[model samples]
Target: SLSDRLQGTFDKLRGKGRLTEDDINSAMREIRMALLEADVNYRVVKTFVSACKEKCMTSEVLDSLTPAQNVVMIVLDQLTKLLGSTESKLVLAQNRTPNVIMLVGLQGSGKTTAAAKLAYLLKGQGHSPLLAACDTHRPAAADQLQTLGNEISVPVFRGDGKDAVAVARDSIQEAVDHLNDIVIVDTAGRLQVDEEMMQEAVDIKSAVKPDQILMVVDAMTGQDIVNVVREFAERVDFDGVIMSKLDGDARGGGALSVREVTGKPIKFVSMGEKPDSLEVFHPDRMAKRILGMGDVYGIIEQAQKVADEKQVEDAERMLLEGFTMDDYLGQLQQIRKMGGLQKMIGMLPGGERMLQQAGNQADESQLTKVESIIRSMTKEERKKPKKINGQRRKRIAAGSGHTVQDVNQVLKQWDQMNKMMGKMRQMTQVSPKGKKKG
Candidate 1:
């Protein structure tokens, strides 16, 4: 995992007072290799590393903190920025009765599945959506949409013997008559983006005046996805993109390349085959996941959304005050309110890597044990772990259905961390006053 690898890279310099040029260079080298291994484009990685190195060169390292961690954060921020620092929403014309969304891609790009997923997503938000099956060429393509529509409880419009343009026209009229707010038109895809497919897609767009033309590409297709997106965008001038099969073990360079090539925002990501598996595209979260950094910023944003101002302020205060066991447990509850631990981690910088590592090391049983142990502690014991001695540890372990050794391990790790922070404080007080590090 990226976090474990990064943590290992900086483990030797954990208590160091400052970062030298050599430290930055060594860390950057490792990061560069990691990015390449993750299948990031070579040019993109080069540019990213150069920018990160420049920032690291000018960055001051905090006393008693690993310069490598600081560098990691810098790289994480840059990665987020490179991926487009915000979520991409589907564009809809304000005064338009029905928002026409045309989906285009090569054959087997999951266009039909994506269209149904989009409809399901829009319906969840209280918008009545209609699915248009413009793919009359492929065998059972319209039937596939009809099946998905039945599952999602949305209407699917299709016309036998009608061309793609005529199908789109009829679907838009049906959407308006039914008072549907959005129309998702799934077009026929070819093995390649040839002149015929291009012209047909353009004709449909011309007929319907689609508010958004989204190019769908399979993430597992690698760099070829970029070429397909470019060809489609050139022909029909798409408004956004949709990358499917992201749940698979794809390196995801295709996403970066497609975005770079088409200059269009990715509106949605299909993680699975299910109709509800579509997510509004968030570039920052994706980038952080790729870099092996947990999406800390994303967590904060979600926490702010669901939590009241006072609760959010309190959590922030606790985090700034050096989190304790009680605070940790409280945070767990708060995080649960927003989502589960795995989900929260997925939103963090290098989150995917951290979750992978954490999952490998500690199974669900371990998490259950940890939660139970925390629950058994008295309020005072949680706030002040120094109060937990041999007898208390034995009592807590027994109550939580764990062994004494398990309880001891948690305490030992916490104590070590406290000692390290203490050393960091001391180092800060003795170090030079003018420079503050990342």
Candidate 2:
């Protein structure tokens, strides 16, 4: 929606070669309004807009580019920078077995769901995870976890008529006896992070000596989530945060403010109510999403993890030499190693916008279809697209589970990009030194 709004603002100047100061200013004003409307913190919005303005004044806009897109990318980058560029991992205690993870939050913040989700994730990762239902104050809370545990085939530990701290302590021993790798203690949530709740959480932490304390907050709560996070952090000295209900249209300003105020990393985000909807929190991607851009930096970082220097060099060389179907396949492999195309796009500068547009045009399955079609091609055919005739296209499409039109579209895009790159090269060659040139 942000992307569409931005595109609409820049639609009038779509064919412009260079942007005027007025164009940049007008587009930025609109972007600022959109962010504010999204419920971003007022101060955060002001700082973000100011930084974007400074960058737009200095950054180069491509020929035939809408300055709006360029400014959008600037804002996106700034937002990503604000969200730390790394995925925060839980710190395990070196001298302890059955690492204790204590969950604390206000009622309805999804603390119970997050605890169960974390257990499921850890179990999937080959860790023997045990969930401890310590919400003795709420009779149905333990049953809730038990139901989820049964669905996921993980074990839930609870003690009848026991104090929360005692239940937590007993769960630790149960984890040890079972040789569990992690013990997730789902504690009680209160209407607010009041002194009683704070003291209760503190007592549980001290009794169990949890290795990590995570404060779960609902993203839709907006700025109020920050206050909850800060209060819990102060009382329990939480090690990390878990943001829930992130799949909704929550502005996510609370995430920024909570992290900034508490200096705690966000360990996970609950995208939905589904068991598998939990994802490791990626600061860069979150930042891009908040700024209404795709996550380009996240893509690059993931690419760097799986890609070596040689693969990148080869890809760059292929792009310069002229992209072939084989080169396209190679690019796909590189992208796959970095994660999937959609995920990589989410990490890019304008990734969110690109993804929103691309999603409207084609789903993720289409990307797989394109990859499959490329995979089905002969090495020679990929290297030389001129050799791909109608028969070849049909065969490739059939093998890759795609329509012939899909193959044609990929080729058409490649051709358009090749022509654009050639024109840019020619222009650069004819341009005057250190001055604007046609």
Best by TM-score: 1
What would you estimate as the lDDT of candidate 1?
0.73
Per-residue CA lDDT of candidate 2, range 132-177, in tens? 9998888899999999998898999996636998999899889989
TM-score of 1: 0.76
Candidate 1, 309-424: lDDT as tens digits: 77766554543355578766666567666645566545443445545655534344555667788889998898899889999999999998889999997776455435533433
Where does candidate 2 have its weakest 10-residue lDDT segment? 429-438
Each model's C-alpha lDDT? 0.73, 0.71
Candidate 2 global lDDT? 0.71
Pick the lDDT winner: 1
Clashes of each: 12, 10
